[model samples]
Target: MEIVLYIAALVAAIGFLVLCVSLAMTLTSLKKTLNEVSGTMSGLEGQLQGVTRETTELLHKTNELASDIQSKSEKLNSVVDAVKNVGESVNGLNTSVRRITSSVANEVEKNEEKISQVIQWSNVVLEIRNKWKERKAIDEGRSGYSNFKD
Candidate 1:
């Protein structure tokens, strides 16, 4: 019976040694895998830093571009205001011209009969002057009296 116990204990010890060896092999494989993961993480961190820097630069450029656009827009607003003022001035000038034209047209319409009478009077005056000149020429003997007409 003692011999049987000794053999059993020896077999158990052997089994324990085998388990330790298997565990060691597994831990060694795990260590190698961890080292590879760490190296990959380092590379990923470097790429992330580069991306962050590029994003920051891009953001800064965007801000500058926006600022430039704002300045240009402000300058354009002044031009727009000037154009609006010019348009208003043109409208005022057109109104003034229209009023003057309307007043002149109204005055001409209101005095049409008077203008016609004045024209008739001028014709009568001219005829009288011509007759007087013919009479004088005849009396002075500057023209043949027989050639004079009434």
Candidate 2:
């Protein structure tokens, strides 16, 4: 009976020791997995920070571009206004030219009869001068006197 009791006690102690060794190995594996997970989380955090910085920079650039576009639009508006003013000035010049042309036409219309009368008067004066020259030559030939008599 003593020998049997001793053998049973030894077997229980060996089984207990094996159980403790297995538990220690499982705990070590769990700790290693947790450390790997923590390392991956730290890398993800760093990448997220980089993405955030890029997004902020992109926003700032977009704002600057928007401001540039707005300034250009304002300048374009001034150019449009200047073009409109030029068009108005051209319209006014066209009106003035048309008015001057009409005034010239009206004056020509009013003086058409006067211009014909003046042409008739010039013809009459030319005829009178021709007659006077003929009379003077006839009188001079009859007298037979030298143009310069002493």
Give per-model TM-scores. Answer: 0.63, 0.47
After superposition, the stretches of candidate 2 with alpha carbons farther than 4 Å from their true spots are 1-41, 112-150
lDDT of 2 by residue, 101-121 (tens): 999999989999998899999
Question: What is the Cα-based lDDT of residue 125 in candidate 1?
Answer: 100
22-108 per-residue lDDT for model 1 (tens digits): 999999999999999999999999999999999999999999999999999999999999999999999999999999999999998
For candidate 2, the 10 contiguous residues with the lowest summed lDDT are 141-150
Q: Model 1 clash pairs? A: none
Q: Cα miss at 133, model 1 (Å)?
A: 18
- Looking at model 1, residue 51 earns an lDDT score of 100
